[model samples]
Target chain A: MPAERRARPADAAKVQRWLDVVAALLRRSPDRLTFVELAEQVPAYGRGLRSRGDERWQESAVARMWERDKDELRALGVPIGVYPDAGGNRSRYGLETHEFYLPFVHSLDGTPARRTGGPPGVSMVAFSPEELAMIRRAAGRAAQLGDPAVADAARRAMASVAHDLAAFDPDADHGETVVGQPLDPTVLRTVGDALVKGRRIRCRYRSMHRDVTASRTLEPLGLVFQLGHWYVVARDPGDERLKTFRASRMSAVESLAPNGAVAPPRGFALAAHAASREAWELGDGEAVTVRLSVAVHIALGDLPGAAPASAAVGPRARTRAATMQVRRLEPFLRWLLAFGGEVRPTAPRHVVQAFRDLAARTAATYGAGS
Target chain B: MSAVARFARLLRLLPKVADGTPRRIGDVAKALRVPAALVREDLQSLAERVEDTSGGFIEGVQVLLDRDHVTVRSRWFRRPLGLSADERAAVALGLAMLAQEGPAESVPAIQRAREKLGRLGPGDAAVRAGRIGPAAPRTAVAGAQRETRYLAALQQAWVARREVELAYRKPGARAAEPRVVRPWRLVSARGAWFLIAEDAARRAARVFRLDRIDGVRLRSATYEVPAGFAVEDVLRDGRVFMGAGAGTLEVRYGPAIARWIAEREPHERQPDGSIVVQYPLADDAWAVRHVLRYGPDAEVLAPARIRELVLAVLRRMV
Candidate 1:
């Protein structure tokens, strides 16, 4: 051996690379092949050690290398066993399929990915083909979301995961029902990175309320996608309240202090923040109750805060009355107006008057004097 | 890759050789594309770890070396492969959303996938994954169930590479007529779904809206889509009916509605906060209906013919 057995496989990165090499050699062999035979069959191994003179090409070096390879692969969960000389043959070491494979029987949860801790990471669990295809769909969605880097990462992850299941029997059929709105891919990826890393971001955002387009630094808490749009729920440092910003309206997204020890305030729930209110309702203001009579043919189920008349209506009725709250008056008015004459504000004389004034102008635009 | 990640990969590699037949370290390494030296070390290390944790080889796993083949013997190794909880949840959410989202014909497949994933049995933590958000609301689906049959039929034709007989109705047409088509791809844009296929009668390509496809039936014959055909190229080639043409129409939006248009629609904004939404109109009547959508918030300043058409619709309505 050129060197002592002091080298450690603690750095799994390097070990990971070596593990790939060893697994490759073992997988191609149908029967047990000795370390001596391995050194001869593997061109790279012999060439690498011989070329670098890193280790003397001898029995001691060979034995030491064998020991280390076993340690790293074993660390990975491969159960490699030694077949003792049964009929006066040299002891051979290899992985026997019956002993190494962990076939899915029942339990979904078991060993942790790592014996140590960080954030929650992957620990293998039984996944059907349907589960895999579902993951593939998400990866596809993430790619379409406008960022190249994320797209590449998603593509790679999908490929690697799909590769893991290549040896398994077909589990299920993957369908084509997938559909999702395209988003600014860059923003989705950037915000997702920030949310996971507890990073702050600086963005030049165009506020929906005003003409102001300025750069603001915020601590992003989470991301929410609604109605084909992506929004980042974030908070200004030192501020207790979180604000939402449409990702598309922001530009020059840059992360700040990725390594800084930061996290959302204790118990900050991303799901709650995302689903608490519709994006339009994120505007700051006092809520107002308003009633609207929409043409009977128009469905108000998707409208915010809309509830229909509980009882049956007369046959002659042309409209159905529903009530909802309004906070962002501009957006609310725009939405109501978009329905044209099919919608009418029936309560609050001031709001009604406002709607009437807009209606008159619209009527005039069509040369139908009001 | 951390030691943990390596461990995870190691676990996955187990099933590759858990059959109890001793495999050569060299052969296993070659198949898995690893160095034999490393494979040898991995087995030895794992054997000890499993032993220490679960009372040495006899309890759960066995690792040994005989005549250079590293063999393992464990009945439990035949277990199904593993995925993380977050990963499972993400997959579940994707399946749920795809099922609810349009491409409605695909719902059955998505449902099957969901069912299979759900079949991991009771006490399965994946089943406990909270409700998944839809990719897009069901409004598009509810807007027209009449179009679903077309979607399903065409989808079948597309998957099987077969020709289809389509009863397509034009945007303003009152009736649908049968037209044979070689279905190619189904593409989505700006909240609308369009089927791109070769029109056998015209011997050219056409883009038909899902709603406009009043009826479809899979034909007996199959089709071979031209190799390397790109849907984007075809759709961009004079297929986008409402975009880019010889001239741009000039119209202004009121301050109240202009911001909304500027925010959601493509247009140019004026210094005074008004927005001009430009459209390349093929005809004045089309322009009139499009602008009338904004009601009084928008006006056609030029093309007197277009203004007259708008007045006709409004005056008639009043």
Candidate 2:
């Protein structure tokens, strides 16, 4: 076993300072920074605490600190380059300006930093205030629900737009608020990068259903947020078979290919994959419509797959029967169970049986007596 | 962050360029939380890496410094990374569910995402996207035009952690009943939105259907919820009716109903394939009304008060 890291408050604050120092250095351009020059300008880099002649002490302490900071920054994706100093040794460090930025596109809107390019019609049209807000919100929502890095990326994408982070409608997610489970931002960003680049990713994935973790190379396809969880559908590069993996369950994520590693089929749409699904499918099962005895005005209006087929007036408004088309019986049953006594299945005996069994088991949890 | 993580972030910020327009070095520095010098080095290293390494992925990728702005000259440098159509769709779908009850201000964002997905990639054909579930927020859809005010008012109170005066129509009630509640959490189930709150008058936790909530007004009074106030306790069996019976409530279902009920629900199954369900009834009256949906297939057998209530209701039906 390895030793546990002794976490300290300064550890985090130090990272921010390290980032700031790097930013300041990049502005200097092809100018190489020696230890003395760096420490003088960026106090965060920590200089030789003593005098200039103390080479041994400075090399052991300050140089070591600088070395570790460079590796840490690199681990975080900072590209620090080393050029030869006056002594012709690779001692000075600097950044190459172009590699760190996106392909610069000057937008008519005048947001100089905004990155934009796609098919012609895509970029030619200008977005209305509302449209931009929606796109930004969608990106914002992804950050809110997925990971911190995801949020940071979204913030960067919308750098041109001036929107407050504490905007309304974000806090109150009027729909399915499954705020219980949290996702690892690192995992989200890794797969996100893979998907964008059309690259394969080697993932240390923990399959909750199978209760196993294994390393597998996957061709990143697309991500879908469903039923309070985010799921990524990836094709097994080896088999060409696609599988949906829960985002939260991914233990480790690493991109295995570069952008454009795999050019997806000429025209592949993720919505098509998502659109054909029955809300109740639950991965396995044949689609079947079941007749349900649901109350009138129950408002089964727009649940995923259980749409209202027909309605029957009952003795009481509460007992009105409604037939619902259930593509996936399991999710449909779970959905019905929420209604409890207000809904029951009368026909398509199997669906009815499933609904009753679920209800009975739920009722039995309280124990027999009352 | 590990190297893989950092590299992934770097990729998102690096878009492929066709034109020679310069991007702000500060933008990359600020976005990645690294210094501009570090970004410059990273870019230089990356460009050199492709030039040095054999068979690099991107073609003719070169980073150039132009005054304060930096741009890449690459044959294939596109947006460093783009969210696939599916990702955008997933986000759009989730937002659509919330849109029902979400503020009108968020609609544009929802619509914008939808349009973006449409143009994301060419689908083989226009395939209908599959949905895992839908959030049919009651007030958002039932009377969408009229309920915006109610939705915003209730959401305001919920966010502020204040008391709310809601005119809620109890099940089967003709008109809404006025009550003050300490809002806790909002829940969605079976295409409907519900608020699990502490009903001041009842002095207990209760789940009120959002649609039945006629009008809601935020109160200035703020209240602290008791410790460990998870909704699972009240949502047990997913029943919203408040409990009234003290002892257990047993319901015996006929074979047809038993077989269906016992399939997954935990219950005491009989030798004849019949099943018995025992539940801690929230309200005896509400329970009676609930069991009535099973019609003649189910009967409440225990807790004399509940049995009496069921019998009285049955007699009235006849």
Candidate 3:
């Protein structure tokens, strides 16, 4: 509603000032302009310079305003370069056209019209129709994820791309992709901001396996969405070990001050942390490799992290032996049970026995009909 | 509005109006999803000129604004800004989620888009490699590929407005039943895919889990999605099983797992630290599997019929 309100006249003047500054910088690009020269050229900053009272104070105030404006422009993806002035202590700024503007997009079949250094003063990027369609669908899917911050970003990205390609429409109907699991949008926004800023966060986390709630301070490394849950991979300051906390289980998430911020270690790869692991491997139980006799019809490639144990015992074997590591027995048993009789544990007598016990108990429970 | 936000919006706006063609202010606002008053304000701002210290004027964008129409005569900012880091991450993660869950046919397109976006620069490359933004799991569970295959076929039928003969197996059923249905839409919730269609025999909408669907045969007979038919009418609040004459069932969770269950949905905590939740039960078989998944951690507290069904299912499993 606030955004819908009519902007005051002063707002328009401020926007005009900002636009004038950018246009001036672009026109005089390749030749940096000092703060003094820019202040003289832009009317808003020039007003302070023209004041007869307290020249030093006025200049400092103007400098602070410039700093804020420069930061805001940079946040908008405008690449403004700052360089030390050769003649004085003042700083000179410039905005390169290529860095400030999007590249000219060309279809794959089109030839390179001009080089980067040509008079057009813009570089070209090529995209096939297939690539654009995928990008469109990706943006559409993200818009349906039910997170406001993520949906906003997705919409803006699609709008920008659609502007260049006449054939692409951002508002086209793409089938929905929804996450059934509920997510706390506020928690996700806080964690995302902290991760991007390289800051620490403190939150009350409820550990599902241990069923305990405690406050923790962690340096967020990355965010991963797996198995219908969003997990924040962070390093606990106390243990100095990485841990993953489900976002839905987090409450009162707050970003720490800049003083508590810490950068991730060098050579840390988030993809490694985000790699998919089986449900059984996510627990804290001791790891053990269990061999299973999988039906021949079931494809081995469908199972991640599973390897063939040995050759089949003759060609007539209806099942093949395969082995996979397990960290927790319960989840593994539950997963295997979902396949009914198609999969069976064949090794580690205790695991096989445990599986039979669970199956038996489940059956007994059902047999005791109300 | 903040000066930066307004400036960014003006940049988006300039590309649309700068072609020197007259456009309705309401039309522009609708396209941009902004208020018409805000668009008018931005147009006025773009047409304003600022005075320099030299007593001269620096012209803003040239524009012609009227009560209902506006046109601009400047070539400045004709192209929209490149995708920002956050935007790139959002898009990359989205593509990753789709690749992990969408139809197999989309994999090649998703991969090609990622490669092209990565070629843009180091920032884009980092996003593509999952160094920035949320990353989706690279691998999926077994039989997910088959589900996606079915998803592709169902999507085609839905788009073509054709009926499909589906071999769908109910929970605990020994064989899949063949049924002809008019495909409406394919929805992916949690990690599973589902097709919301109208069963021809019953002439009623039904939600069929894609994993339970053994085969799909497209039919030459076509049908229209009923007027005002909405996916929400079937999947209320992202839930799959919403049947007519559904009854409320209560289930209790032990204290150890109560907090986890509470995190998932609303529930009432009992004095003993256990929590009780009322769920809408549309199918008795679905309720049986749902309770069994929790093992002893959960128990049926009400609806004796469901309790009996759970016991019967467990006995059958044994």
TM-scores of the candidates are: 0.56, 0.46, 0.83
Q: What is the TM-score of chain A in candidate 2?
A: 0.54
Instruction: Give the per-residue lDDT digits (tens) of candidate 3, residues B1-318.
Output: 766678878888887777778999999999888989889988876665444335664544678899999998655556665666667667887778667666677788788888766543224333353323333222111113335557656766775788999988876674689999997777776667778889999998888888778789999999988888777776654566658667888998878678877876679999999999988887776676666666666778769898776665444444
Between candidates 2 and 3, name the one with more favorable TM-score.
3
lDDT of 2 by residue, A1-370 (tens): 1123222335423533454345555546557777666665444443343344334544556677777777665434345666677779977777544433322323234443343442222232244444544554455545455455444544544442221121322222322233424567777677766665567888787664455689887776776555445677777765655677777667678887464465444455554554435456545456566666656645454333345555445455654445555556655665554453456677887766666565554344323321
Error of 2 at A365 (Å): 8.3
Give me the candidate number with maximum lDDT: 3
> Candidate 1 chain A — worst ten consecutive residues by lDDT sum?
A113-122
Candidate 1 positional error at B198, Å: 5.1
**How many clashes in each candidate?**
103, 44, 1
> Candidate 3 at residue A214, lDDT?
94
lDDT of 1 at A164: 38
